[model samples]
Target: METAALNPVELEIARNRLESISEEVGTALIQTSYSPNIKDRRDCSAGIYGPDGMLISQAEHIPLHLGLMPTMIKNALATYGADRLVEGDVLITNNPYLGGSHLPDMCVITPVFWQDELIAVVANMAHHVDVGGITPGSMATHATEIFQEGVRVPPVKLFSQGTLRQELLSVMLANIRTQDKTRGDIMAQVAANRLGERRIHELLEEWGAERFAQSTHALVGYAARRTRAAIEQLPDGTGTFTDSLEHDGNQQRDVAITVTVEVSGDELFVDFIATDDQVDGAVNCSWAVTEGCVAYVIKLLTDPTLPSNAGLMEPISVTTREGSLVAAKFPAPVANGNIQTSQRIVDALLGAFHEFAPEQVPAASSGSMSIMTIGGFDETTGQYFSYVETYGGGQGAMPDQDGASAIHTHMTNTRNTPCEVIEREYPLRVEAYQIAENTGGDGRYRGGDGLIRHLTLTRGKAQVVAGTSRVTTAPWGLAGGADGKPGSVIRHGPDGDEHRESMTRFEVQAGEGITIQTAGGGGYGSSPAAE
Candidate 1:
């Protein structure tokens, strides 16, 4: 038998170059971005893709963004052909229906060509504080439609033939809340994309564009095969689970999520046939976002060595009704559904797996995106700034041990921005940034605890927004283990009274302190191993 041979030395170097582009792009964005979200919080991802838009590599950034790149690339190519895309022309979009997670997550993609031939595309996506709509932060729980959610930009050319699109820039700046921050962030994305294009061209010159493209395809397929092998290990049947969100960010009813996961010889199928239809609030998620969430869950338990690509998803089939929470339909506000809905799905699936494979599954992790948004005047510069902080909590203890504390759910791989950086960047003062003691649910093998973040508006006024879950229905423990604690957001109100809101976006006076407590992870099986 003859074996196909690939140069191991050249392949490793090409892979390194592919991933390094993201690192460079991340560093450039962090250094130049005007908002604390990008600078301090690092809510961004960068990647390099083949001209076909198949993701070749990524910097270890947000798994959501990384996993969804191929879809976005496919959409872009469908809209703009390779011949139409030219040098220095950049494309931007944030339409979930087209291929986006939310209304606020702005994605910029630029194609790279060498000697008039397409080589690759440099892509980057970041969370903009505001993109214009009824809400200041572009994420209101009451959003009923895509228009109400925020400005939705189809795949438009932000730059064409190496020239800036002044009209689009002006319109974007006017529609958004913070003009300075939004404009600056947009430019930052352009620069990072340019950087990636340059690096990719250099790679093309170094390792012949055709050869590099072949290698990318090879790498992607390798990952797909590895993922299939991982899926083959399950009990070769089906597992079912159902989870719920307390409320859909409105006075709306609770949102339910259901999954019928099938495992066969070397493939997995996750069906959301029983999930509730689209609700009236922003708690709906687009199909692209649903794919990201499912991929995250599969990756956590499956082969970590697999490259996240279309090939990886080849053996995995995911189905959901267009209007369900998992596959939010068109015109439904899905800005919040990507985060909240997906988190619950993760918890539910993990819970279901616990019954059959107790050792493979543990208790649920913090069930929400412990998010905080603070925007107001800065006393020092007398300027305005908004600081958004996303915190994580613990994963549930296993059958034999305790849960790990202060880790984000599978939805994110980002770290909490240091309090020092937060205070230094914005006018807010960090009073208490510590772990919430005794907040974890009690079990023989106790679950992990959450965090307590206290922010004082030392400035005159601040508009604060919070998006957290497990505030009512706490993280539940499994198989004889105790439950995890619930989360909350409390504000010292006008009359010195404490006001708590489930998913709040309100104003705070000078004397107010916003205290946000994150949810803990659930606990696993019985007390402990028989001593």
Candidate 2:
């Protein structure tokens, strides 16, 4: 299985084929999914991994999901040994402590076999709408422990040798609020993995297992060389920066996140050991998530065209303190950590990188996902319905170009759920959806404007959970630019307008509505007028 015999052209072709397989898997999942979260918003990711759980290639999907997939698959494989896994078996898990971002994000893994030998594995993860929690949506802002957030599923066999585990599936669906959507999405994941398996088998048929393995090994090594070369371009330096979370749902404010980046030779080291301890609310993220955020910033700073495989991570090393905000322990609530904290982590890292490479970094963006979840009984359908969505915000402005307005930036890459879909599916109405005027900071290159979305209950009463950031601490500006405007949430009801906290859970009546105003991005440089 020596890769020395493989030529550059052949290796490039193999790389493209593998990447296409991952992209095809993602397409299959989105097309077959039942929930709007996956079908319309495309909040899902797919990847192909080697037999040893090393990432080979991934689709250009969510950055957060792509980086964490390798860790999740490796954990699953370690939990359930290869001897226990069969050809058609699919493993599932959403335990944050066990290498997952949150409880709602479910990962499905399938092992590909060639003549009784395990050669590769394909996996996909999707954010299910709801998974049995104290609140209607699984992301409870006030939830202090993981038990209250949602149903926790550890690494287990969802399918055994092409047979679905009916009893286990039944138990899982019984706990979730949107049973049909969850079930359908799970099946869609299975379908995606199945397609990946079939495609890999086709490749193995064309080229023997030995050649296939050799090509994959060669691709990974090539990516490693490219990443190291990119790192060598940066001057050796150490940069440190600190950022804070305005509030963690449980009244804790200014939860600090510190990062120190060191570039030596062709290697990079990111240390988060100085970060604050885990809080009492749902703002805590696991070590895998912290690593994912660091990996994302590394890719952006180094080379965006680098192949997204395990090799890309070879020249980078990350260290985080155990039980810290960026590396929470078991039993800590983490629903918002994946969406909210991840954004802040990216901002902190970029801020540190700016110290050494100011031209390479951009001003901070809206720095929030603006997640909104509403759930209750649907009068029209006579069933329970839960809707979950992450609203896009201002994108950070670059040195030479203006930022994009009302777009998903940094860690998230999801689309906004269409207004028509919300009105047609759930007991809610999209009263208004537009960009916040003049919100982006003014400079040589202005930052992007934030979004304003207002939603009203259409029929029955519903419970709403919203988590946001950059409310108290505005998105920071760089290179003498101005700070972006902060965000705010309000409830418009019979009692008039009432401001809400950064993280809050409330009930809304049929006539009541909620309005979310996201933060804008920081400017890149001082405006000509100011100059």
- Top candidate on lDDT is 2
Per-residue alpha-carbon lDDT of candidate 1 for residues 1-531, written as tens digits (9 for 90 to 100): 122245778556656767788789877887889887887778888887767777778777887777666787778777777668888899998878766788778989889888888877888899998887766677777777888977788888999999999999898877776779889998999998888888877777887766777777766776677788888776676778888987787763577898888777898888888999888888888777777777877777765666665567888898888778777778889767756777888887776665555567778778887677777656677655667667877677776778877777677766778888777766678889888777776777788989888888876777777778888878888877767888888887777756465676778877787888888877666555522
Off by over 4 Å in 1: 1-11, 376-384, 399-401, 529-531
* Runs of candidate 2 exceeding 4 Å displacement: none
**TM per prediction:** 0.94, 0.99
Count clashes in each candidate, considering only residues at least 3 apart in sequence or on different chains: 3, 0
lDDT of candidate 2 over 111-171, digit per residue (tens): 9999999999999999999999998879898888999987899888999988999999999
User: Candidate 2: global Cα-lDDT?
Assistant: 0.90
Q: Model 2: C-alpha RMSD to truth?
A: 1.0
Residue range with the least summed lDDT across 10 consecutive positions in model 1: 1-10
Cα shift from native, residue 44, model 2 (Å): 0.2
Clashes (candidate 1): 3
Global lDDT of model 1: 0.78
